[model samples]
Target: MKRLIPLLLLAAVPALAAPVAAPHVAARSFEQLAKPLPLPYAEGADADAAVAAAKARARQAHKLLLIDLGGNWCLDCRLLAGTIELPDLNGWVKRHYEVVTVDVGRFDKNGQIPAHYGITGRLAGVPAVLVVDPRTDRLVNKGHETALSDARSLTPQALADWLARWV
Candidate 1:
């Protein structure tokens, strides 16, 4: 009976463990996403000021800073923007992050933004998402900066999952 009780307790341990919840994602496929995807990067806006403001907001809100370094001309960047703006995902993002989009025109402009995170030289690709810890002003997801650079090839849910991983 003692041995049986121990086995029963071990079996119950699995059930007692809390399940990790998957991130909320509304779009299952690319076609389900909104048409004429949003151009999130503002070419004329001051990228430095925007990042500063976002960092401030993130610090105050106790949220992470999500710096989206990309260009309006990039299709993948647009795709990532549109997926993030999905009604459900947008709300989730707002709850967890302060987002700032900086236009890196042909990877020529906004070089300093990525450099600020210790990512020198040319970037891997557009939509280099710098997940920052606003409290410390440090990049959280360092090596994975360009993980979503090929957003076009991934499903919206996959993108949402990637964003959620930082949180």
Candidate 2:
């Protein structure tokens, strides 16, 4: 009977361990931090027109144009988007850069945007960011376009610091 009781308890162990849901942070919006989260990338969108409009807006606003190059399918891209959408950071981005999301679908679509910035090949990874000075259309942070590529590993503070540096 003792051995049978032990075996019964062992058999119930899996049932006893219930799955736990992650605790939600109060400040994060539903759209900002949802699972398979909502990102701001437009698939098959025209990068040229987007850039041109952003350039005009940046020129008028006297701000840099921040081109977020990635697809909606990328988790890192979505993470970066969510990080930037944080209330404080969102205001900073609006003040300093005219943000544009250029969707590079599986490294297939929207290759021209980066090419326009003189990068001939496909990017090192998704969420390749390009901060361009509207006045000269220069790539301000040339090699660091993939700074946010490792969004999964970066802390919110690190991302904020990176954004602040360019501003």
Candidate 3:
């Protein structure tokens, strides 16, 4: 059993180490991304409202929290959001930090967001998950792309790892 454990991990490493859809997204051009992207959640709530509440919660919480710097209009953002909110992944996430999401489109014009974090000119991609310190507004972690776009490819697990950096 012990000897086979190495083999088991070896077998799993390739599957887990890289994303399945990375190549497709990495190869895509800006024109490909110009279309509508899907997201896990609705643009149901206001971005500032959501962030305000999450930041308020983080004020009292002692864990390292994440501020997802993306929006519901993005594919990579949606994929990452769905993964983190999954039962098992959320279990791990809740253990380490609080979470909030910022809408790149709406928040960019505000002074609260840095110019570098702006999703302008080029395609910002929906799910550029940026981990930040809610208390201090310092950036801690971020992920760029997923299989949805050609310029960047990201998988759920790969996205989770990036969010893990914030946690």
Whole-model Cα lDDT of every candidate shown, in order: 0.87, 0.79, 0.51
- TM-scores for all candidates: the values are 0.86, 0.78, 0.53
lDDT of 3 at 116: 42
Query: What lDDT is obtained when candidate 2 is compared to the true structure?
Result: 0.79
Please report the candidate that would top lDDT against the real structure.
1
Worst window of 10 by summed lDDT in candidate 3: 20-29
Better of 1 and 3 by lDDT: 1
Ranking by TM-score: 1, 2, 3
List clash counts for every candidate, in order: 0, 0, 9
Candidate closer to the true structure by TM-score (higher is better), 2 or 3: 2
Give me the displacement of residue 125 in model 1, in angstroms. 0.3
Pairs clashing in candidate 2? none
Q: For residues 49-120, write the lDDT of model 3, one tens digit per residue.
A: 666677677767755555555656555565555555555466767766677665655444332533344434
Tens-digit lDDT string for candidate 1 (34-119): 88888898888999999999999999998999999999898889998888888878888888889999999988998999999999
Candidate 2 on 1-167: residue-level lDDT in tens? Answer: 98899888977864254433222233333344545565789976788999899999999998989999998888888887877776656776788789999888899887888998888897899789999999889998888998788877766656766876666
lDDT of 2 at 55: 93
Candidate 2, residue 35: lDDT: 59
